[model samples]
Target chain A: MSGPAVVFDKVSLELGGTRILDNVSFRIESGALHCIVGANGGGKTSLIRSLLGQMPHSGQIRLEGESLGPVGYVPQVLDFDRNVPMTVRDVMALLTQRKPAFLGSSREHRAGVDAALKRMGVLEKELRPFGGLSGGERQRVLFAQALEPAPSLLILDEPCANIDEPGARIVEDVVLELNAKGVTVVWINHDWDQVRKLAHSVTGINRKVMFHGVPSEVLTWAEPKAMVS
Target chain B: MNTIYESIRLTLQGLAANGTLPQAFTYQFVINALLCTLLIGPLLGALGTMIVVKRMAFFSQAVGNAALTGVAIGILLGESYTSPYISMFSFCILFGIALKYTQYRTNLSNDSLIGVFLSISLAFGASLLLYVSAKINTHVMESVLFGSILAVDYTDMNILLVVTLIASLVVLPLYNQMLLASLNPSLAHARGIRVRLLEYVFVVLVTIVTVACLKIIGAVLVEALLLIPAAAARNISRTLGGFVAGSVIIATLSCILGVLMPMQLGLPVPTGGAIVLVAALVFVVTTVMRTTLSRFRATGV
Candidate 1:
């Protein structure tokens, strides 16, 4: 319960006969804001998937320190036929409520859902169909879902992608607040400016861990040309 | 079975006593057919919502098509051509699982996979049907393909009843998990929901329903019953509850209307075709209503 929050030792992944990540190794400290930066198709999502146990990988991924209780994941934008009618409350109920959603949500969980939505500034849209919400609004709702029960490690994949300026600010604020409350955050980020401002530590990954250190030092060490190309 | 028939007869007689139904409706065959529809309609409506949400329309269609092959195999195995429940259920369930497993393992899109399975099943069924044509009466094949509600015997009714009960029990508790898996499988998996297992269960359930209702709805039009009601409901619903409820209502209405209209009008149309046509009409109306409402809202009228 006192060691690093996550330890990735010699992690290698080969997907569909292509090497996605090779010999990647890193350790994320407990209660620290860690940002992962990599170019497109550079195994950023693959690395997260490996950590989430969604993909097969070789080597060790140990979630140490305090039992690693209840990791929250805010996945990328949902890719589905949005025409399937489902409201935000329905989605939340699918995740949080134990009973069947078709039977209707229990009153006990409604207040909790409302509180979470309010925190994400989407309380009014709680009853709106998820397909009808704007992309930014959907992102906020997803964030709200992840925040429920307060995960020990919150893993977000491109939390700001396709979000408006105000939505981005709201995300930043919520992330900072979670980090301040001792929630370990592993963010996959694209904006270097935000990484510099928010990340306690930054790791440059391009199929492997190229650099890992404090944000300032890692920023100087990770050259864009070397990492991406 | 006799008691069931007697009770249905009495019910129809009582309705006739109150001048609710004509004397023609009290016949045993008519009563049996109506009871079968009552059992199958709401279940189809409920399951169809998930079928549409998960984009498994073609998959269900493939299952339906596979039922023909199942029947053909049953005939080849020397089972009664008229009631081939064993081979039909086994073959369709296996076929559905294989389709699902192949889709999971390969990169083929769902529709393409279903198309492949559909073609293969149809080819197999056609050849077997031709081979068995000399041994069995052709009218049996016609009934399997296009449905004959008059053939909904006591055994078929009991199977439908048991299937409806089992399907309700299994699907009701797992409904949310299945919906979650359909909406976002990775998230559901992260939450410890067995996404793959749930998917297989859903596929098998669709197979069961398709096979059970084949005698009344036919192999060719069963998927239509599974798809059109949900599609129409989706056109008007804003929430999952409303979508499911609307689908049930539309499906039940379509089933009743499809059956009674043909009987009342003395039309010689296949019951399955009649049901599908009714569902299609509902879909068209709902689509038009949705478009009109959206347009009116946009124009502030």
Candidate 2:
């Protein structure tokens, strides 16, 4: 339980005949906030997918400490039809309860869902259709869902995108709180200022790991223009 | 089969004697049609919720249309015209798998892929039908296309019942996982759910349901039963439980009304068309209700 939480060694990915990532490598320390930053189409998402084991990649990704437990994920955007008649409560129930949703959620799970919703400040909208929520509200709901069945490692892909300022602050605070609880967090962010303020370590990735170090050092490190491009 | 039918007939006859239903309800064909609808309605309603939520309406429709080509191929292969289930099941399952696999492998939009499959299947069916016309009575094809509930025999009813039971068993337990996958595939995958595998499983289920329903609802109109009731329920439901239950209620009610209305009115309309029209009417009613409710809430009246 002492080594790095995750280690990626020479990871590479080829999708649809395009080389999306090449020889990317980095180490994420346990119980730390690690952020990935890059330009558009820079393979940040592909990297996250690889880490989540959603896509195939050529690499050695080792979970160094305890065996990887349930990994909570909050995707950047809600990728469902807006008109679907699913309530926030249903979403929470689906994630937390093992029983079929049609059978009605168990009382314990319902209370847990309510507590999680309350934590994310969307408790009032629990009974409302997920499609009816505003973008910010939906983001908050996503956060609430991910926090349930607490994970040892949390992966967020651009958690603040498309959210309002206050909503963004709530996300920032939540991440900080989770990190303080000794949970490892891997976040993908485009905002360098937020990365500097929040991340304990930063990895600049452009197809490969351009730099990986403390935020200040990585920021000042000279990156080859050709490699970045 | 005869025993089951006789038991149902006796029950219906008792009801008729008690002055509950029309005397015609004791007819074997009418009783079979009612039983078919009673089983298929809730099954379609439950599966249709996922179909609509996953935006797979076109995919299911394509599967339905492919049933015609399956039947035509069955007839070409010398299978019985009345019960060409072997080719029907084989062709539709393969068609659904091929479409799903192609969509997974290629970058094409689902709608475009479905359109391609739908056009090809329809063309194949038309060509094969021309060949089949000389071999069998044209009325056979007509009944397959428009659906004559009177044509549902013991075997078809048994198939429908088995499909309903099997579908409920497999789909009910995995319902939440399927919903999570449809809503956010990457998240579902991250949680160790095999998203692609679940998707294929769902497509296969839809194919099975579409094929099993072809004789009662017809290939041409089966997609309507899978779409309209769920959509109508979505308009009035605020939660998933309510949505699925409302959908089942709407589908069952529509099927019963559709089946009984033609008998009561002595209309010559096809049962499939009648059922689809009833579902459409329900959708319209629900839409109006939702709109009126919104308006009332807006004015705080």
lDDT of each: 0.83, 0.83
Clashing pairs for model 2 are none
Top-TM-score candidate index: 2
Badly placed stretches (over 4 Å) of model 1 are A1-4, A222-225, B1-5, B17-20, B265-268, B295-301
Per-residue CA lDDT of model 2 for B1-301, tens digit only, reads 6687779878997897787989768677888888899998899888889888888888767876788888888988999988888998999999999998999889577789999999999898888889988998867666556666766888888888888888988898889898888788888887788888998898898899888888777766667878899999988887789889989998988898888888889999767778888899999988888888873122111
Q: Could you give the TM-score of chain B for each candidate, in order?
A: 0.93, 0.93
**Candidate 2 deviant stretches above 4 angstroms:** A1-4, A220-229, B295-301
Candidate 1 per-residue C-alpha lDDT over B74-116 given as tens digits, one digit per residue, 9 for 90 to 100: 9889888878999989999999899889988896877899999
Worst 10 residues of 2 chain A by lDDT: A220-229
**How would you class the docking of model 1?**
medium
What DockQ number belongs to candidate 1? 0.50
